[model samples]
Target: MPTVLVIEDEPGMAAYLKTELQFEDYSVLLAYDGLEGLQVYEDNAQVDVILLDWMLPKMDGLGVLRRIRQTDDVPIIMMTARDYVSDKVAGLDYGADDYITKPFKMEELLARIRVVLRRGHERATYQVNDIQLDTKAHSAVKNGTFIQLSQREYTLLLTLIKNVNQVVSRDELLDQVWGTDYTGGTNILDVYIRHLREKIDDDDSDVIQTVRGIGYTMRTAGNDN
Candidate 1:
């Protein structure tokens, strides 16, 4: 199940968010303070998204954002009563994917979350080399043959497929696929790419190309090849 991390100092607001997110069939993690929020993220790196508050006790939301940015790039939606344009700009500059104002409608927040997640999953499949990824179905197929993928493999594949012909940087893939909550620093992306190549490209042709000093890109096979 998809998990959400809610970091809000206000008890009532936090509870409301938790309850609402749960209603959406998402596993919700609640943090009463920024410090606790960071701890929850550290303990559970698989969190799909985060709802952060601007102000909090035991470290502020921006600080938490900075710390998380140093490692994980999980999508964050900041909520604040301060409606200043400057505040929104600051949050975006600090790496927040989206921001929400206080007293907002639950439907709006849920809509934003859906858009972000959908975009993330959309990148998991591509049409290059006669392969298509149906993200909603969480499956990939080549020439009508279904490809089975582990959860992480599916996410990583989607990231590459989404950027089919573009050079997707490691950091970008990490932030979007691994999420901002991931703290691991190994060559996990490389492993997944190799796995994908083996299953999707190795026997036929190399669809995923590694641009030296840049990132990976997928190319469709030409008739000559």
Candidate 2:
């Protein structure tokens, strides 16, 4: 059975979610605050998904998300009352797999959770040439050497590698890697791409190619010809 960790502060809401998840035959773990939620996540290795609330007593959802992304890439669905696009983007950019607004239908939430879980099972790791990424382990290895990456860098590289040889647009990259709510200029993508190149491509062999106004494409050595 898939284990779900619900990190919500409200007693009523938490109870409601627990009951519904139980009805669906999902094993549910409940935590009323962000701190407790984090602790629960650390202690329990079986947690497959997390339904995180944006507002909490001890720590907010974003803080919790950041901390978790430091080590785990488990599918997270962020629940928030804030409906603004900016808020959604912030959650996505912070590494949330999905976002749900408050006052949502339980059925819809369940459906989204199913989709995220399915996707997680479908693509746990990706490999091209000598580069490898283990999404479950949240680690990247290149030529038998572990590549140390910041959270954003890891997310960025994963997105690129998923698409492989296809040209991933700047807008798409921003939306997927930085979140669509990103208000800053697109130069940030360039910066991160440069960082990835420096780390992943030691010989300056153009593993990641800039497509001028379009975006970028990740090319493996085997596909370069």
Off by over 4 Å in 2: 121-225
- Candidate 1 residues 20-129, lDDT tens each? 98988999999999889977886775788899999999878898898776545678889999999998998999989899999999999999998777666333234666
Question: Against the hidden true structure, what lDDT does model 2 obtain?
Answer: 0.88
lDDT of 2 at 36: 93
In order, the Cα lDDT scores of the candidates are: 0.80, 0.88
What local lDDT score does residue 121 receive in model 2, on the 0 to 100 scale? 49
Cα TM-score per model = 0.55, 0.57
At residue 25, what lDDT does model 1 achieve? 98
RMSD of each: 6.9, 8.5
Tens-digit lDDT string for candidate 2 (1-225): 999999999999999999999999999999999889977986675788999999988888998898777556899999999898998999999999999999999999999999998988444778877899987866799999999987678878988898998999999988776554569998999999999999998675778888888999998777753
TM-score of 2: 0.57
Specify the poorest-scoring 10-residue window by lDDT in model 1.
119-128
Indicate the residue-level lDDT of 7 in model 2. Answer: 100
